[model samples]
Target chain A: MGVKSTASNNATIFCNSKRFFRKLKEQKYLYMMVIPGIIWMLIFNYIPMYGIIIAFKDYNIISSFFEAPWAGLKHFSDFFKDDWFPIIMKNTVGISLLKLVFGFPLPIIFALFLNEIRNSTFKRTVQTISYLPHFLSWVVLGGIMITWLSESGMINELLVNMGILDKPVAFLGEPKYFWWIATISDIWKGLGWNSIIYLAAISGVDVELYESAIVDGAGRFRRMWSITLPSISGTIAILFILAVSGLLNSNFDQILVLRNSLNASSSEVIDIFVYRMGIQSARFSYATAVGLFKSVIALMLLLLANWVTRKLTGKSLF
Target chain B: MRRKFLARRTKGEVVFDIVNTIIMIVICFMMLYPVWYTLVNSLNDGTDAMLGGIYWWPRVFSLDSYKAVFADSKIFRAFGVSFFRTIIGTVVHVFFTSMVAYGLSKRYLMGRKYFMAMGTVTLFFSGGLIPTFLLYRSLGLLDRFVVYIIPAMFNFYNLLIFQAFFREIPDALEESAKIDGANDFYIFFKIIIPLSKPVLATIALFTGVYHWNDYFAGVIFINNPDLQPIQTFLYRVIAETTSVHMLQNMPAGIRTTSVTSHTIRLATMIVTTAPVICVYPFLQKYFVKGMLLGSIKG
Candidate 1:
């Protein structure tokens, strides 16, 4: 009786396997289409994920990355214990917060005012000019900025001649001004491009709202504040949550371009710290530990922000 | 009634419009002047540029900087590397990403949920820099041209963009193709792809621009100067020349050149930036449409 039941079970398993193959064969082309991408993802993305174990290991060039001896949180504890930890953490959190305060609102304000423009040509020109910088790599912009902010460059010349300064000051050379420059430049590069979403959101608001506001003798500013702002608040909430979640990134490209030894005190942030420690100096384990710490924090922040956003605004990234 | 309303403007409203227009014009000037300043400086004689009076227009109107930038053998090779990766990277990105999106867009495709979850999980979490770098090193990708194109072939965001686009094709379109005995592959190639030109162009533009602009990958993966892209090469030049003493210490080619480091910097900037800015207007409409669709749909 036991043998007979086992045979029937084997038969049923075989039948299920055949049906699975037949269904797969029916959409064989679709399967073929997706196979390469999945394979690529598996290699380039997922495989690297397993490499995260290096953070807990004493990894080096001689030893295989996976086979390296486990250090078990030694790297993580070492990073937190390091003297430069406070400086980098402060710089990262400070710059990100400043950017959140200054950079976040410029685009929204620009979009709001831009919507008031009656002339389509003027609006289009402003938009085109504004977004042009967004396309130019920071390598170009940073080079331009170096020249512009030079002691003898246009900015210094204008300030000295205007009598706003006794002499040309090296803006990039000073630590006090570095944060503002980073934040302002971030806004400058992204303001117009970022406004595209808000502008899109505003466009979807009912046209009759505007017409009725006109009937009610409401001014443009009044209509904007009462109707437009409220309409796009959902988008603002979503983006704000995403931005808060990304506060750890601090835009390595921008810092790498703009930073020098003179301003490294203020400019050195988490991502730059990782690059210097990991790629440049080849402190692989410590860098991975720092990176893993940052990733975990970022994930927590995202979840927290999403929760807060839903609680406060009835909208969330999720 | 229309004529009367057009003729009437409250004094305050008129004043507000005038103020708004003036502010807009000033903003426009502020936005344009930085790029304009760079062009003026780029065109001026390098030595004259150092004297600091040049503004609004080139003072000496010399093309020596441009000539010098072109004369550099490294710049030529860098440009070649940049162009090669951009074209190849963008094509592979659009092609495979589209295929994957097409598969996902089909409602009846098996294991779609698992496939989607696999891709989506990556958006939030990743093995950090060390792991990714080590993986590349282990795979023998470092210092090779394949480093730029391979790792970036399947952008998760672009996958969503492609999926959103593919999902929009009316069901009837695919149904008719199926009824005519065309398989999924045939319909995707002959029908969906031709109709997806706008989206494909948009994704291509994004991927192409990314390849053009990215120096971070080159910084991490490629150590050889010959394999470096234009941006990375320019970054090296900028980093080296920031200290005057360093430039003086450099091999004679840069120090002996007639062009100032400032002018050389400007020329390099223009060389790297011009192509993207020039091609921008043609891609602008599609870019906006793509951004809107991706944002709204995602």
Candidate 2:
């Protein structure tokens, strides 16, 4: 009985291996097509995942990632105890929430405003021009911003000429106004381009709803409130979830470009802090710790957003 | 078209329409004036621009700023670097991303689910900046040109886009090819790729734009000035407006006679921005298509 069972098990294993090999052979070309990308992802995407271990290690540039001495929770504890932690946290959350509140709604409002335009030519022109800034790099936009915000720039010129201001203000140099500057610049750059989805969402609304509303003597405002906003609410909800989940991001490019020593108090966020600590100061372990903290929080937010979105709208990103 | 249904207007509606049009026109002017501000200053006489009356156009129209940018050998090199990276990076990125997407789209293939998950996992998580920098350092990829191409080859979003596109290509086509004794490689290269042009174009336009605009890679990966893209060079020129670096590594003697630092700054912005802007009209449709497609579930 033992001999028979052993033979049967061996036969089963042999059959499975044969089938697996046949399957591989059948899809060999498809495998070939994707293997390079897989390998690339493994190296660029997955391998660094292993490097996340350095968050707990006293990692040195000279020392290998795994070879570094394990200093359990030292880096994280140090981050918690550091005075800059709260400041960075405050700045990151502050800027993110501000952007979420201000930046998120601007595009929606812009889309609604745009939707009201009866003239296609005018609407198209506004959209095409607005998206131009979105394509421009932070470096260029920063230069543009600096030029505009400069004492001699057009904005100051306009303000001073209009008697709205007593004197030219160095908007970029002040920490107190950095949030507003960042928020406004973000809206300026993205308002049109970000509105594209909402516009598309608005377009997908049933034409009959509007036509019927007009038949019932619904005014433009009333029809908009009844028809357009509700139809596009899904897109808005999805984008809102995405925006909220990205609350920790804090517009790294915009901040980095606009940041200066004077405004560091308001401008320094989690990403900038990580870049400074990790690259500039060579505090790899500490930076990794902070970065890990950010990623963990980001992950939690994403999951929470996805869960909430699924529960409410029956749609999710996962 | 929307106006035909309700041409009759109340005072409130008329007022709202007027306000909306005014707001749009004002916003349009605001958006445009900054680029114009930089432009007029770029073309103005360096000394004249310093006096700050050059608003509508150049006070004494001169080619000084453009000439100065052209004279800077580093700008030339940076442009060449940026141009070459955009071309090669875009091609390699589109090909590999599409190829992977094609493979992952084959749900019946063995282990395809795991492959797709491998991609989706990377979409949500990353190793952050330091570890990536350290890993690149260890791999001797820091400052290398291949660093641009390899790390960016497989974008998960592009992958899903390609997968979604490939799924729409009927299975009957592939089944017929298989019956003809043509393998998946032959089918992909000859049949699938030929039919995949629209999606390919959309991906190419976006990833190309990304490559052209990227300087964060240079900021983190490469410290060599020679290896820096035009964007990074402009970034430095903008950030360090007062430094000697603004003078294009030229001899100090030429500095006093050259364009003002501000003029040079505008010129740099123009030179960096114009390439992308030039292609915008041609590729704008593809991006709109691509972006909307992204919002839809794959």
Question: What are the per-candidate TM-scores when only chain A is compared?
Answer: 0.94, 0.92
Alpha-carbon interface RMSD for all candidates, in angstroms: 1.3, 1.6
lDDT of each: 0.85, 0.84
Task: Please report the candidate that would top TM-score against the real structure.
Answer: 1
Residue A278's lDDT within candidate 1 is 93
Which CAPRI tier for candidate 1? medium
A248-310 per-residue lDDT for model 2 (tens digits) = 988887888888776788989999999999999999999999998999999899889988988
Per-residue C-alpha lDDT of model 1 across residues B1-298, encoded as one tens digit per residue:
4344336667877887788888778877877788888888889888888888788899889888888788878888899999999999999889889988898888778898888899998888998788899888989999999999889889777888888888888999999989999999899999999999999999999889899999888778899989999999888777545645224422246533347877877887887888998999778888888888888755
Q: Tell me the TM-score of each prediction against the true structure.
A: 0.95, 0.94
**Model 1 over residues A1-318: C-alpha lDDT tens digits?**
585457557677677778678779988999999888888888878987888888999999879876899999999999999988999999999999999998898899989988877788998888887788889887777777777776777889999999999999878778788888889888888988899899899999997787777778888789889999999999999899989999998988888888888888898898999999999999999999999999999999999999999999999989
Task: Please identify model 1 stretches exceeding 4 Å from their true place.
Answer: A1-15, B1-8, B244-258
Residues B1-298 of candidate 2 have per-residue lDDT tens digits of: 4577556667787888889989999888877777787788898877777778667888888788788888788888988888889999999999888887888788877887788788888878999998898888888999898888888877888888887788889999989999999998788888999998888999998898888888788787888899899888887777555223234534243345447777877887888888888888677778888888787853
